[model samples]
Target: MRELVFALEYEPGCNRVADALADHPDARVRSLSLHATAEQLWRVDHATGTPDALDAIEDAFLTSDYYADCLATEDCGATQTTRVLDRTDDTLVLYSDWERTPSCASVPHIARDHLGESVLFETRHEGRHYTWRLIHSGEGDVAAFFDALEVAVGDCARMEMLRTADTTASVGGSDETQSGLSPEQEAALRAAVEHGYYESPREVDVGELAEHLDVPRSTLTYRLRRAEEHLAKQHVADERLPEDPSATR
Candidate 1:
C-alpha cells in the first residue's frame, strides 16, 4: 500500500469552516471516521478547544456555506444533515452527512473518483491548515487526482503535497516500535526538530519554540523532556533485544 499526505489552506472568506479554524489557533479538529460514496459522505469529527472556540466551531459547522454548497439542488440531489453526537465544556463530537453532487468537489469525492473506493482517509485540522492522509492499495493516479483537486479548489485554497511513499518504507524498519507519546508531546518534539532546537548552535531556544507553538514555555519544556525520555527508553530496549534470538550469545 501507499500513503499520500497533503494539506490545504483556504483563503479567508472562501470557507467558513476554515475561517473558524483559522480564527482559533488553539483549537483542533480530527476526523475519527470518514466514508464517502457517489451519493453522500459521512464523517465523525472530534474537536477540542476552549468553550468559546468550540461554540464558534459548532455554529460555523452547522451553518457553513461549504456544506450548503454541497447540498445545493443545482449541484446535486440528496439530503444533508448534521448532529452533535456529544459535547463537553471544551470538546465536541460532531456527525455530518453531506449529499454529493457534481458541484461537490471535495477531497474525499475526488480521491474516490481517482483512487477507487477502497482508499482509507484520516484528517486533521489546526489553525488555518487542514491535512489529509490517504492510504490506498497500489500506486494510483496520484498526480491526476492532485490536479483535479487543485482545479476543484480553484482560487479558494492552496494545496500542498506533504509526503507520498510506500507505507511499509514510511513506517521505518520492521522492528520499529510505536512512539508512546501523547499528541502534545509529539507536536512539541516535531516542532523542536523542525526548528533546529537540537542543532549544535541551537537555532531556536525552548522559549522561542514555545512561543512559535503558542504554548507556555514550561509546558513545552515538560512535553519535550517527557518525549525525549520515552524515546530514550525505547532506544535502550531496542538495543537490548536482538533481532534474531539465536544471534545473541
Candidate 2:
C-alpha cells in the first residue's frame, strides 16, 4: 500500500469554503481533517464571520441543493463543518462512536462508496482549487477510487495529483539522492528566494510565505533553516575536501 500526498484545485463557486476563500485571496484554509463520512474539519485564517469575509460562504450554504450545516466563529478558531446530502447506493452509515450519525453531506462518502472505508484525509488547501492529503489503504481498486472522487467533486471541479510516495517514516526520495535535503526543504528555500522573501526590506513575510506555500509558518521557517544549514555545511565541506594530503604534491 502507498500513501499519496497531493495538491488539488476545485472550480470556485461550487462549494461554500472554496467560494469564500476565492473572494478573499489573502485568507486561506489549512490543517484539514476529513472523516470517513462527509463531515470535514478545517481551520481558516482570519475568516471570523465578518459580513464581507464570509458572504460567499453563507450564500453557498443557503443555496446549495444538498442539506448543509455550519459552525463558524473565532472561538471555534475559525473552523467549518460541511455535510451534503446523498441518496445513491454510496450513502454512508457511520459505525464509529467518535463519528457523527451518518450524514449525506460528507465528501469522504464518495470514496467510501467506491474506494472501501479505509481512506484517510490528512491535510487540505482551501483555495479556488482545494488541495488535500488523501491516504488510501490500497485494499480497493485504485482506479475506481479516483474515478469516484472526480464524480463527487463534480464536473466543474478541477483536480490533479501534485506528488506521490510510498509510506515510510523518514523522508527519502529523489531530492535526497541529488542533495542532502528533502524536496519540501528545497522548495521552502526556493519559495523564500523567489518571492524576495530574503531581501533586506523583505517583500514577503513568513506568514504570507506560509500561506502561499500551503504550510504553517513554523513549518516553512523550519524547512528554510534546515535547508540553509545543509547548504552551509555543504559549502564548508566542499572547500575543505581538496585540502586533504592526497591533493598535495
Candidate 3:
C-alpha cells in the first residue's frame, strides 16, 4: 500500500492545525509527532479516497502565510502539487537534491533524526515535480496524509500556477494505476489460491475457506468480486485453470 509521513513545519502550540485537518470530511490525521516549534503528523487513507486530499495538506504548509511572508518570494520559485506518482518504504535510505534551505533546511535533518524510519513520495511543483521524503517515528500507514497533501496542493494558487506553467514534471501514471488491489480483495485471492477452489472436479468449498479465514462467506464473495475486477483489468492469467474447461465439458 502507498504511505507517507511528512513533518509539517507549523507554529508552536497550534492545536487548530490537527483539529482543522482531522475534522475534514475527506481527510483525517491519524497521529501527530509534536515538538516545541513544529509537529510531524502521520496520516493514512484508503486508495479510494478523493484525488485532492494530499495536495490540500501540502498547500497548508508550503504556502502558510507565516512562512511565505518570512522568506524571499523569489526563492519560492514556482510551487507545484504532484500527486503520488510512486511511493515506497524499503530498507534503503533515499536522499534528494532538495537540500535544506534557510527556512526548510533544518526540516529534513530534524525530521530524519526525529522519525528514523521514513518513506518518500514524488511531488510536482507546477507540473514540474520532484521527490520528498517523510520521516516517521515508527511504521504507520500515512497514505491519508499524502492524499490530503495532494488535495491541498492542487488548490494552492502558487503551486497550481507552477504546475500549469510546466515547472513540474512527473515520472509515472496517476494514482489509479498505482493502486493494484484492496486488502480485502488480496485476502480473497489468497484464499482462492490456498483452498484450490478454482481447480477441476474436486473443487474447494467457499464456505469452508471463509470459515478458515474467520470471515463471513458473503464478505469473501465481495472480496472475490474485487479480485476478479483487478485480475480482469490487469489481464492477469488465472493460474489454477490449466485448460479451457468449456472445451472439455
Q: lDDT tens string, model 3, 1-249? A: 223312232222222223234334344322112221232222221111133544444344444433311222234332322233222231111111122234331322333433343433332111111113332433443344444344333332111110111113232112212335544556677778878877775367789878988866645654575468667865654555478879889
* Candidate achieving the largest TM-score: 1
lDDT of each candidate versus the true structure: 0.76, 0.52, 0.36
lDDT by residue (1-249, candidate 2, tens digit) is 456544445444455666665666544434323454444433222223334545554445445433222211112222334433222232211111122233332345565666567777655434454545556665766567667666555554655543444566344433253465667776888899999998999999999999998976645655676578778988887788657676685
> What is the lDDT, from 0 to 100, of the residue 202 in candidate 1?
99
Question: By lDDT, highest first, what's the ranking?
Answer: 1, 2, 3
Error of 2 at 102 (Å): 14
Candidate 1 has an lDDT of 0.76
Query: What C-alpha RMSD separates each model from the true structure?
Result: 7.2, 12.4, 17.2
Model 2 Cα RMSD, 1 decimal? 12.4
Task: Tell me the TM-score of each prediction against the true structure.
Answer: 0.69, 0.47, 0.26
Q: Evaluated with lDDT, which candidate comes out highest?
A: 1
Q: What is the lDDT of residue 70 in candidate 3?
A: 20
Residue pair clashes in candidate 1 = none
